[model samples]
Structure formats: C-alpha cells, structure tokens
Target: MWIWFHKLGSPPHFYRTAGRLVPWFGIPALLLLVAGTVGGLAIAPPDYQQGDGFRIIYVHVPSAYISMFGYVAMAVAAAVGLIWRMKVAFAFAAACAPVGAAFTFLALATGSIWGKPMWGVWWDWDGRMTSVLVLFFLYVGVMALRSAFDDASKGDRAAALLAIVGVVNIPIIKFSVDWWNTLHQPATIAKLSAPSITMDMLVWLLAMVVGYTLFFAAVVTMRLRGEVLLRERGARWIRELNAHA
Candidate 1:
C-alpha cells in the first residue's frame, strides 16, 4: 500500500495511470448517464404525491449524491497528501475541487427547482439544505485560497488543511435532515429497510448515481492532466506530453 501510494505521488506514474483509467471511467460514465436519463425521465412512473414534478429526482438526487461524494473524495485526497506528504495527492485534491463544486452547484439548482413546486418556495433556511449550501461555499473557498498564494506548495498545503477541517461538516450535512426538523426530506435512498421507492425509480436513481460518478472521473482526469502539465512545466515529461498533444 505504501509503495503504491508513493508511486501515485510520482508525477509521471500518475500521468500514465490516469491516462489509462480515463477511458475506463469515461466510457462507463457516458453509458450509465444515457441509461439513467432515459430510464429516469421516460420509464419511471410519476410520484403518487408530487406527480410529474417528482420526475426531477433524476437530476436532483444524482447531483446531490455526487456533490457529497466529490467533497469527500477531495477531502480524503487532501488528508492523504497532508499526512503522507504526497504531492500527487495534493495534485488530485486540487484537481477535484472544481469538479466537486460543479456538482454541488447542480445539486443546489436542481434542489431549488424541485423545491419551488413541492415546497412552494425556492429557498428555505432548512438545516440540511443550508449545510449543503455551506459545503458549496467551502469548495469555492478552497479554490480561491489555492490561487491566492504566490507559492504553489504553500497554497496546496493551506488548501489541504482547510479541506481537512471542513470535512467535519459532511456528517453534519448528512445527518441534518434527521437531527433537525428541516423541511427537506430525510434519507430515502440510503435507508436500511428496502428503499421507499418503486423498482423502476430505484433503478433510474442508481443509474444516475453511477453516471455522475463516471462524469466526475472523466472531468477529474482532464483536470489532473492539466495540473500535471502545469506542475511539470520544465520536466522532460512535459515535452513528451506536449509532443503527444
């Protein structure tokens, strides 16, 4: 494990490995997303309560799921970089921020749209929703702090620290709907008992989740590739990469 971790920290090794995995992630991501969309929007039946408006779940739930997943991925990468002093982990943490933020943004947007019809309001001070908003802001903050530093290494370290600190909020966000009397619904898909949803709805939701996971992998690969180029600007690998480009 240590050997693999160290190897991943090496720029060339990561570049080569990511190049290989991109296609693996990319192909499945595209296929799953198409399947999820078609199944969710067309095949899944409308909610008995919310009617057709509930169909937004295809977009909303998947985006919300990915938003949290991305944050956790970024924070975990940052933790690895800080504890193990892995430069590639830092590169991955940096690479993951924008992608995570984009998912969070999608979640918020879809949530708001879902809310207007279901809850009769576009915005609310509910606990879970509010914390998720904070999570989004946290992503933005980390990205801004990264650019603010004149020293790149310092920036990486600082962002890593912030991410580690901010991770405490993830559980808070996850549990908020339960702990507080928030208007937002509690966990439906992650429950211990059989899902509260129909098989059709469940399948579509799972498909979307898989698709979003793939989309994240695809975007992160592209971003990581860019980060490698910037960090390895004067290295021989850069010349080789550029030649290939």
Candidate 2:
C-alpha cells in the first residue's frame, strides 16, 4: 500500500495512470448523469407540495453536496501535501479549487432559482445560504492566494494552510439548517434512519450525487495531469513525453 501510494505521488506514474483512468470515471459519470436527469425530471412523480419546482433538486442538491465534498477533498489534499511535502497532493488541491468553486456557484444559482418560487425571494441572508457563499469565496481566495506569491513553494504552503484553516466552514455549512431558522430545507437524503424522500426520487437523487462525484474525479484527474506536466516540465521524462507528442 505504501509503495503504491508513493507511486501515485510520482509525477510520471500519476500522469500516465490518471490518463488511463479518466475514461472509467468520465463515461460512467456521463451515463449516470443522463440517467439521473431523465429519471428525476421525467419519471419521478412531482413533489406533492412543490410540484415540478422541486425537480430542481436533481441539480441543486447534487451541486450543493459536491460543493462541500470538493472542499473536504481539497482540504484533505492540502493537508496531505503540507505533511508529506508531496507536489502531487498540492497540485490536486490547486486543481480542486476551481472545480469546487464552479459547483458552489451552481448550487447557489440553482438554489436561488428554486428559492424564487418557494421563498418568494431570490436571495437571502440566511445561515445556510450565507455559509455556502463564504465557502465559495474561500475557494476563490485559495486560488488567488496560490497565485499571489512568486515562489511556487511559498504559494503552495500558503494555499494549503488556507485550505486547512477554512475547513471549519464545512461542518457549519452542513448543520446550518438545523442550528438556525433558515429558508433552506433540512437534509432529506443524509439521515441516520430511512431517508425522508421516496425510493424513486431517492434513487435519482443518489444517482445524481454519485454521477457528480465521478464527474468531479474525472475533471480533477485531467487537471492534475496538466498540473503535473506544468510542474515537471524541466524533468527528463516530461521532456521525452513532450518530444514524442
């Protein structure tokens, strides 16, 4: 296990391996996304209360879930990089920032669209909403901080530290709905017992979540490969690979 972990940290190995693995994640993600969209929008019965407006959950919930997932993943990678001094891990954390930001934006945008009909307002200063906006800004801040320093190592460490420090927001984002009176609905899928949602809707929602995760993996892997090449440009193996290309 240690050997494989070290191998994954190696630039050439990770680049080659990620290239080969992209299709595995990408194809399944696309298929599941299509399936989930069709199932949620077309097959699943309308919410007895919200009707078709609730169908936005197919996009909103997954994006919001993934926004948090991306932050956790970024923080973990940042921690690993800081502790182990692994360039690959730093690259991964950097790559995750933009993707996570995009998902956060999607979540906020969809939530606003869903909110207009439900809450009769497009924007609110509620806890859940405000925390997520902060999370999005965190992603942007990390990326900006990373590019602020001329020294690459300093930039990586700064960004990593920021990511680790900012992780506290994640739990706050998760429990904000419960901790305070908010417009956002409480979680229906993540529960100790049976989910509040029906099986049909649950199935599609779960599929979208999985699909979004896999899609994130596919994109991050692709970005990591590019990052590896950029960072390793002066290395002999990268030169050889580039020469061949």
Task: State which candidate has the highest lDDT.
Answer: 2
Question: In model 2, which runs have C-alpha deviations exceeding 4 angstroms?
Answer: none
Return the TM-score for each candidate structure: 0.96, 0.98
True-vs-predicted CA distance for residue 14, candidate 2, Å: 0.9
Off by over 4 Å in 1: 243-245
| Residue 93 miss distance in model 2 (angstroms) | 0.3
Can you write out model 1's per-residue Cα lDDT over 112-206, one digit (the tens) per residue?
Answer: 99999889999899998899999999999999999999988889999999988999889999899889999999888787777889897889889
Where does candidate 2 clash, by residue pair?
none
Residue 105, model 2: Cα distance from true site in angstroms = 0.2
lDDT of 2 by residue, 80-152 (tens): 9999999999999999999999999999999999999999999999999999999999999999999999888
173 Cα displacement, candidate 2 (Å): 0.5
